[model samples]
Target: MKSAHQRFAGRYRPPSPKRSPLITPEGAAALKKELENLWRNQRPVITQAVSEAAALGDRSENAEYIYGKKMLREIDSRILYLQRRLDLIKVVDGLPADPNKVYFGAWVTLIDDDDNERHYRIVGADELNPSAGCISIDSPLALALIGKQLDDRVELNDLDRGYDIIAINYVNATST
Candidate 1:
């Protein structure tokens, strides 16, 4: 009974862009923790719930059974993604060769035209958290800053203004 557009609408979306294959050591640890939790704690509980709901009879009309099945599928999908991503990711666990220049895992300070200072860390895509001042290595700003020395001007895309690199430091991967 579904319309043609309705069927095609859900099928014709473009594929998502590929993510970078780099991850910080901390990020890798977090992913591993999540996978363990899902496998050890969450999956068993959801399986039990589904079994109990199915035992109540008439699964076709059982809301609990349907919801449990959906939740199980979601968890399984996430677990698979984490497993695959963890295997493919290369963890950056050491300092950059040159601490004076911008690189992966480097904390960078930039001064803008108005003398406003911004602090950011260039991290892997898996570890990029904007609220914590982490920028993905693939970002335009990070891309422009990489291999640049202190006091260098960074041109981010077509922005009329440029930011001057003020400082660069690399923290130990374990501490992050």
Candidate 2:
């Protein structure tokens, strides 16, 4: 039997669709580093603060104790999520078989009908940073660009917006 709270929680939030399990090597490394920082540094510091605060007086009124516990809970939740994500993800490294055509890790240059040029890299979801022009492979634009050759015109699923692939290059991260 489900409790009322459990029923309400389940009703309010539908389960999300499964995300792609691919991640770039750099993105995987970043996730691992974050997990290490949280476990080795932040968790220990918060645990110590909570213990000290609890020793001072009644924890019911101890603001420091309450806050420290909350911080610890947040950090632990993040650590668990990172661990699960890292376990599920497969890191994609090295260049694609066809460097001239767009694939994962390829930097694509596109020209809109207006002749405005834009550059985007199709990376795994974990590596997406829109400000840096790194787009997720699952994104509509990236999906549209996949396997397309240079000068190939792409019509997106969205209404009427299309782009011409001007260039495709797989820039090795180690290369200048």
Model 1 scores a TM of 0.88
Query: Which lDDT tens digits does candidate 2 get at residues 1-176?
Result: 98899879856967776777888787899999999999999999999999999999999999999999999999999999999999899888987787888988888889998899998988888788999789999988988899899989999767588999998878853572
Native RMSD of candidate 1 (Å): 2.6
**Model 1 lDDT, full chain set:** 0.88
Distance from true location, Cα of 49 in model 2, Å: 1.3
- Write the residue-wise lDDT of candidate 1 on 33-142 in tens digits: 99999999999999999999999999999999999999999999999999999889999888776778787888888999989998898888878899888999888888
C-alpha TM-scores of all predictions: 0.88, 0.88
Off by over 4 Å in 1: 1-6, 172-176
Model 2 residue 155 CA deviation in Å = 1.7
